[model samples]
Target: MEFRRPGPTPTPWSYWLIRLLFKFVLKIFYGTIVVENTHLIPEDGFPCIVCANHSNSLTDALLLVTSIPSKKRKMLRLTAKSTQFGKKTFTSWLIENAGTVPIQRKRDFEGQEVDNTEVMHHLMKALEVGDAVCLFPEGFSRYHPTIAPFKTGVARLVSDVLSKNRSHSDFKISILTCSITYMHRQHFRSDVLVTFHEPMVFTPKDNPELLKPVDYNVIRDLTAQMHQQISHGTLDSPSWGLVRTSKLAARIYAPLGTRMSLGDHVRVVRTFLDAFKTVRKKRDQSLVQQEDDQHNIDPSFISELETDLKAYQDQLEKCGIKDDRIRREILPRRTIIYRMILRLTWASFLLIISMPGLLLSLPVYVVTFYAVRNFKKTGPVFDTYDEIAQYKLIYGLISGVAVWVIGVLATLPFVLITSLLIPALMWMTLRWIEDAVSSFRSFTALGRLFLIGKDTLKEMYDQRKELHGRIMDMAIALDLPANPEEYFAQAGGKQKGRVQGLWESKAKYFSIRRRRKRDWNETLRLYDKVDYPDDDSEI
Candidate 1:
């Protein structure tokens, strides 16, 4: 049975209550979300479908639905697998009340086929009422940056909606394109960027009841168009490690007063790959052809890049740090030691104060580490790193509740105060550790970069300077932006940090880091205000 509310729309009270709660939950754990062109999002009281690339698991769907403008959230309906709605619980109740519709998309148990006619009926009903539907045309989450083959479900939905609105003199249905990417998906508190591309509009054909001969072709063409638009917003990486290495080298070579914001880091890495491709296409046209056919950027480029960065990568490893810290802090600074001391001092103080909470959460921490460390589910479809992040969150929340319950039991008379303190302290403790580690790691590396009299470290910096100088020369020759300060001043960036860094002879890969303060000369505003088109100009 399909789950539907008593009426056309979900109760506004229930909808916003859970929507805000879940949205807050994701924000607390998943990290910062940056949305581009939010004004382009279609308004409520219009029939529309929001199509997006699926990268992270359930989080992907949540992000698309939650991150839209608040007023339109109530009108949004997510098309979910039918199986999930069968169970009656808080999750199901919440989803159904959030205006979700179940689609029996394929074969079910006992080899029986699902009845799509019912699904289509419910969807058509939703469209008649001007509710916007959100669907992932791709059935599941992709493990990488590349978009998978798109399913034609969205096209069918658009056609069916058009058919139902045949009686109206003016028919309008819009498909909005949304593309999102995760900078560090496997890490908690990482960043996400969501871009809402322009919408595709459809008008009724000449005949209301009969279908147009070209409609099928139009649907197929539209599917292809959506795929292309969504892919453009995706973060394509031939080699994440190589990309990170290039940023490190970029920092060494970039002009003075150069600082890149997080967005700027993304722009730089993407620009590098794009530039690399354009350059390599001259040397080998066939490799470029394969890349154009949806193969990742030529693997040969990453191989050559790794070879070029070998020495610098090794030196960074020895310092027990990453290239990001040097690029983010040291390179931009006329002075470094003073900032390092203050950061170190602050981190130590935080650690001392957070111990009470840390000690209480120790048991949960041990379990989290054990579960994450022993995770050995390697298979063709497995993504280990992202899965690890998922587990940390699941375990952390459950254990947190357990700790609070224990606190309640221990302090019966003062249960309310004690219980609050236990969870509060534990949350602060975990958050503190995550932050302190980044600062202290950089502090240790600063010592090696400046204070430690190590020959290898000195040689590494020297090599870095020379390579960076060459990169600057190349950028100038190509007429590219070679200075981060100027480039970021113009508003551009990319994600940069420790990727699969160089082979560390002395230790495991150091933790990844990004500067909290972005190096932007000017704020990059997200959108220009726009007035909605009038009835005649809707198209």
Candidate 2:
């Protein structure tokens, strides 16, 4: 009688315990996990390949595994480097207990080269038994904004699986494209966007021989699509205030708050996508007007449009949204619910975090104002380094004074109980100042350089607003809508009516607005008035 090793057990209790632990840790970390298209996962036992772009840090696998629904969870396994298992007992336990298959990357194992053949065999065996295997085609994590080229292992594995079961060739291996995105990966309370593209069929025709040469192209196209969907889907339909608020939350309050719920994460992503689309639309409209004015559209216009179109195309491909039926059914519903939930959750979280900071920072805020004023005036007397050092000095002084004042106020009978509040306030005030200065310097060095006096800049901004108001009045008098929003909308609507005349109305709208602003400036002699001080000094 021959003895054979039994197949990997379901480990129901282990999986449930792991999941419970995952929930507890997520709560503790305040981590948010968003999973898109959970329905795509087959409920019945089916062989499937889970391929995701790796971009997050090491804990990405944890995030992915934990977010998977419980029913299908035990059937999943990951491919990990053998070296990780060799060095650490804990890592080895994690790999084995988590059902990870170890593969050597560079060295030979037991007289065989570190080729993926054995790994592919193990994966295929697992698949034959209806297991879901997770693999990062890129092999490792990479930076955002671009995806690395995919290794050929995935293509090879699919090819082998099809070849082994010729009659069952229609065995239907579902290839799922997954993407995990982060606001700031290492930071606590950061939002994650997990998007799932519909399952793709890896028919025999999509074999290694045919695909190897063009595999990169296929992966690139797919990965780009995933990035755009995950990236833009997160941003769709957010108000400007909400967008700004979310960004602020990610930076400050995000660190302090608990991890966002899956629903909240989806909402943040949708808000971002909506904002991106709005900005892109505005940009396109402006470019169209510029092209019509020049009487010849620039080649660069087409290039930019092509880029944006490609992004959208790629996104569609990954989400398997290319199926018109699925898109029509899923997208609208998901978008509406996601937006509502995000707005409420985000607003609540921001209010909770910011309220205490606001109340506590009040007294220290007075000191911060004085420090800012002094820092602005002292810039002319110091170079960049000197100015920064002096600014730090002023900050320390203010913080010290605020601390002392808070301590004294706490000593009062009613205030003593409240004195604990002062420490938090002081901390928040200093942090806000640091963040503001850092952001200000990054956005414009001139902000720091010209910090000699900001009153002049304030006056200039007021003058510009006045000029813009006068231009709007002129536009209304010229029979255009008084509001830019109404003017653009009407123009767009009219342009849509005439396919051949698309963009002509938008061109005319902007031309009228631009000409009006110019006329208003001339009428007010604004430039001449502002130039006088400089001219007088030269004279």
lDDT of 2 by residue, 1-539 (tens): 22222344365565455446544444323223446677777543667777776654235566667767767546567777676675544435555667678877653356665666677788888876667788877665543223455666665666567666544434656677776655434332334556676776665445434233344565545555544543443432223333332332221111111122333333433432333344445465674333322223333443343343334333323422121211122224345445545544544454455566656555544665565566556533112212222233234344555665767675787686556556555444433332333233222322222332344334433533443454334233334344433333243222121122347534643221111111000111111111111212211
**Position 439, candidate 2: lDDT:** 31
Deviation in angstroms for 282 in model 1?
A: 8.3
lDDT by residue (1-539, candidate 1, tens digit) is 22222233544677677567656555656545667777887677667789998766556767776788877545577777676686864446666777677877553445776677887788777766667788887765556544678888888777777765665646667889987867666555666678889988775654332233335666777788999888666655443544445555444544322233444455455555555545355445555334323324444543455457656765665555554444443442325677688779977987898889877878777876787677734533334443554556556555656777877898999987986777667656655665576567557666555654445444555666666665565455445575655555455333322222245311432222322322211111111111111223211
| Deviation in Å, model 2, residue 154 alpha carbon | 1.2
Best by lDDT: 1
Alpha carbon lDDT of each predicted model? 0.60, 0.46
Error of 2 at 291 (Å): 8.8
Candidate 1 CA-lDDT value: 0.60
